[model samples]
Target: MTDKAVSTIAELARDFGVTARTIRFYEAEGMISPERQGSQRLYHPRDRVRLKLILRGKRLGFSLAEIREIIDLYDSAPGERGQLDFFLDMIEKRRVDLEQKRRDIDLTLSELAEVERNCRNRLSELAKGREQA
Candidate 1:
């Protein structure tokens, strides 16, 4: 309800399964701004939510710049519509990129399998020639 201390940096790191330094890095990157009280940093609900979004975006392979755009859009004049539209576009782009990666990986695996089969057949032929000798 208020911008009070909902969690400390350590608490957020423990809950989010990230290191304190990582949270600090986000703070430094202007992604999330926690309230600073002398030596201790207190995270409010907004900070917590933003941290969650940052982690999720990272897991989804989003760059820090892309994630920042989404987070900034959430607070800008366009609000949720801009945020949602941008996120949708990002999702589509990510999908296409991942699909291409998948195809490349599949092609690499097929080539590897072919190489392995050739290697085994060469080994078999060598063994047969030795036995005939």
Candidate 2:
């Protein structure tokens, strides 16, 4: 869409593959402010961009408050540099957390496999003993 192109909340939701309620939640949270056209919410290109950023942040495990802080810096005195630095820090933290979670999951899977193997072995031993008896 063009820089000046505007869209309705329904259009934005459809394009973003999100529910209208989700958009409304973001709106209520002061994330995206659409134009009010006699009860209809008309979203402009700027709001659309913000919504995209918000969704991207959510996917990256950032909270709405964090996303808002980053987006606010875009037009604030801190400018692009501050936003980038903050986002990078968030990315690093999230990466570390995710790596720890991966390790935990791997360890759990390994434990499960060992338990299964032991159960299979016990069953096999019982079957052989029954056959001999």
Candidate 3:
């Protein structure tokens, strides 16, 4: 294979800012499939691209199962409009979930602020009582 078409596991890990163990984990999860050269693993360009996509999917908070579904489509439906539609649907679902999480967080933070304010007010009252006593 041409050098441009193949890469070592270390090379891919370094290039992608990931650990060798992370690559191995992805390989184990079937997210990437590197060819075995004796005890060494040689990654093809396709594997490299899949690793990049896997990392991107993780960064976007997608579960491995979801990432696997999307990655599987690359081979199963290359250049198909159906794939685009499916991907768009997934994106909308993710967006709705994330927005709901954001709203929940906002409410939690507001409640925390009110609790903190009450605690501080109580502390000030106690301090004033002690001073007056």
Best by TM-score: 1
What RMSD does each model have against the real structure? 2.5, 1.6, 2.7
> How displaced is residue 94 in candidate 2, in Å?
0.5
Q: List per-prediction Cα lDDT, in the order shown.
A: 0.92, 0.91, 0.87
Model 2: ten consecutive residues of lowest lDDT: 1-10
- Which is superior by TM-score, 1 or 2? 1
lDDT of 2 by residue, 1-133 (tens): 3344888878888889999999999999988999998999999888998999999999998888889999998987778998899889989999999999999999999999999999999999999999999
lDDT of 1 by residue, 28-119 (tens): 99898988899999898889889889999999999999999999998897899999999999999999999999999999999999999999
- Model 1, C-alpha of 54: deviation from truth (Å): 0.3
Candidate with best lDDT: 1
Query: How should the candidates be ordered by TM-score, best one leading?
Result: 1, 2, 3
In model 3, which runs have C-alpha deviations exceeding 4 angstroms?
A: 1-3, 78-80
lDDT (C-alpha) at residue 103 in model 3: 100
Counted clashes in each candidate structure? 0, 0, 0
Model 1 ranges off by over 4 Å? 1-5
* TM-score of model 1 vs. true structure: 0.95
The local lDDT score (0 to 100) that residue 80 gets in candidate 1 is: 91
Instruction: At residue 44, give the lDDT of candidate 2.
Output: 86
